[model samples]
Target: MTTEPAADPQAGKSWSVEVYRFDPERSVKGHLVSYRVPRLEKMTVLDALAYIQRYHDRSLAFRYACRLGMCGTCTVMVNDIPRWACRTSIERLGGETIRITPLRFLPVLKDVLVDYAPFFAKYRAAEAYFVPGEERAEIAPISPKSRERRAIDPNLECITCGACYASCTMLAHDAEYLGPAALNRAFTLIRDSRDGARAERLAAVGGEHGCWRCHSLFNCTEVCPKHLSPTRAITGLKRSIVLDRLRSRLR
Candidate 1:
């Protein structure tokens, strides 16, 4: 059998962790398990989980890949808010206890591992793929400085970590809802000068589970790791749709 890596002795020496535990193969309902860790400089919440898994218990379940926060797989609810544990330093938590749980809107596969199928499904339903036309060779070169392109610049940095989806109340209430991230993706395409799918994308997001469902609670914006605001993008889509409707009426 392979041995698990040892915990760093210098990590936070006097912090308590409360982990939400659920195993379909082993647990009846689910439970919160607590672990105490040693204090160290600049330790993150991911490091705390790593220490618990290696030294305190071997069966605890959580998901992580890149320890530096780029992979987006290490997102979890810390102190009841969705955040990337890899980037959340223990010292910044401002408390003696840290509570960890799976993302809110998705089904939990285990302790902190949420099923991403529903999240990705919404993404696919948004028709987020690029649509090209036969006249691609004749297409004029587009400048990034164009007003429309610049409008979508902030949205392109999304890592699709599902943190926004997890914190969205609109998605929690309506399972069929296409969430902020997906709608943001739609906005990007809609704003693109070369895209041929504007009408189709607008139709996709114009229905019940579309842009109108957003309540502007800003939860997605609050939890987003990249600081990109899908809320603003959704608002922009609403304005565009409203203007288009008015223009059609005038015609």
Candidate 2:
């Protein structure tokens, strides 16, 4: 007589979670470490990480702030796609497996934590700060229907998560590329009529490493956690560059 094996009740409730492990302090090179995690109702990627941190491994390193997904601090590579860990649910990813890693284009500081120096450096190179139009005594009124405002509004909700910059294919190839986040930031300022730095800002984002270099593959738009479109902004900047050069020739 053949005996039938009993089916485990926990069969479909567990997942294979592989996280990229690295720690220069411990002399461990980067590699993926697997963890078997049990499924919970509506559990998020960040929740899984938190569970691992609390129960399985105490030495694992990751970053998160404003667990509500407001700070964009929990950004990581989830199955080769950059995402906000706090907001990405396990159920949405098929509940079978998950792989987490540091931003592909940035230097890894530790296990999933990346150094954002280069990302912000390119941001500063674009002169992203507002060279405010003469100090306003009160709120300077900008019409909602104005063409410039319309062009600039959609691109301004960026959380500076470095997700767009990290996912950019240009950065994967060229280390010096200004990247989508920087160029997108420059576009916002350049389109503002009240801003005094149009010429300088244009120069900042228009050189060999600037908006003209965007491949327009839409990778930046795809991986952005905030849904901001850096491709659209870069295209607008390219148009402005052409128009600016023409105006200069006419003058």
Candidate 3:
């Protein structure tokens, strides 16, 4: 975590970084701490945080991994918008001051770090995983052009970073709501020809606290790091439920 301050050659351009700070163990109330940092070309919010920690304040805490944007772990609220810190370039932001905070709808563990336990709990409640079918001597082959394959292709890119979960307004009001990430995972598995527990998966996500609760605000779609759309996936689940009910009634 230590780096020579001189290593950053572009330490001339100054910008203010306003960070949300709190610790339940040490502090009664959380507040924002400001630091003026040097900006470089292509400097990301993650870079700014690293600079702040390395130079201004070692006590500043945040979560980040694989600074290349492939890992969703570096997610933070930038000016009230949920975005991957690594992916957001400071140059793109036309402001001299940037507000950095932990994701919303989750308890803040510290500065820019939020508790994800509740988020994963919703995931499990939705049964967001593939259940393999009976074993066979040979592996099954699925065509790339198949409807199910095409339907789930984009969703397979989900990194489970909780960006969609954090950006979700639905989760803010309804804690029990199976968030976009979980429901999106459910939709992917439901559409997968390789998964055998489609009925059970559907039941999990179609319950009272599931896909039906989504208000279709599309916040999940806007904040997705991988550019995948959970709103579309949740809609797919809703359509499946309607078709299933219609089939049962007709029979």
Candidate 4:
């Protein structure tokens, strides 16, 4: 895919890119490989990666889809910070050299690609999915201004991007800890009055390596593409757990 571009004065400018390379099926170790990329106006990190994979080295492997950042396929560490590659412009990066690497604290299946199984497993452990009650004749209308809806609103937009999970110091220390996204998901489900598994889900998130384990570092919130606040959700869980226990003792 070594395609010569049409005449343009900006063609002379290029970005220095260093991408991590690995193939578990073949090699036991990995290394960083560098390439020179053309400077296109408002170009993104994903654009650079595609250029490398196509015009430079077909063997280079990375994942991407829906280049609009809705899909987390192009998630990677740009200069050791977790971010969506498709949305990160080179201009925003503010440097001529771009360093790309895989997300940390997960098994790397290939270059810049981490297995999402562990991240998702924690969500399952937290019982993050909604457990609906018996089927009804009609859908129940939830008020937009209701307390439950308001509580669930700010923390409900998680994209499952794993940027928070990757940047989390808590997860790095204790792998058993239910991380930001999973805990955030649990909070949303717990706040829904219609969910059948409120007690069970609340107990799950309030237990060991659960919401209490979070240090409120806010790393997840910082890198969140959708601007969700998992730290705050965890804190809400902590408050709910305490109140629920106090009520039980009083009763």
Candidate lDDT (C-alpha), each? 0.86, 0.87, 0.87, 0.88
Give the alpha carbon lDDT tens digit for every residue of 1-251 in model 3. Answer: 98766643434478889999898889887998888888788899999999999998898889988998787888999999988998899879878889998898888988889888988888789999778867768888778888868878877788778888889888768888999999998898888777898788888899999999998999999889898989999999999988888998999
Instruction: For candidate 2, write residues 96-117 as lDDT tens digits.
Output: 7899989888889989989989
* TM-score, per-candidate, Cα-based: 0.89, 0.93, 0.91, 0.92
Using lDDT, give the best candidate's number: 4
Candidate 4, superposed: residue stretches over 4 Å from native: 1-12
Residue 125, candidate 3: alpha-carbon lDDT: 96
Q: Which whole-number lDDT from 0 to 100 does residue 228 have in model 1?
A: 90
Give the root-mean-square deviation of each candidate in angstroms. 7.0, 2.4, 6.4, 5.5
**lDDT-best of 2 and 4:** 4
For candidate 1, the per-residue lDDT at 153 reads 87
Instruction: Give per-residue CA lDDT, model 1, range 1-251, as digits (tens).
Output: 99999985644458888999998997677888888887778989999999999999888788889887688888999988889999999888888888998988889988888988988888678777678643655756667888877889888877788889889887768989999989988888888877788777787888889899999989898889999999999998898888888999999
- Give each model's clash number: 8, 0, 0, 0
Q: What lDDT does model 1 reach?
A: 0.86
Model 2: lowest-lDDT 10 consecutive positions: 7-16
lDDT for each residue of candidate 4 in 1-251, tens digit (9 for 90 to 100):
69887775543498889999999888998999988999889999999999999999998878888999787878899999999999999878887789999998888998988898999999999999978876678898789899879878889767788898999998778988889989999988878888888789889998888998898889989998888899889898898889889999999
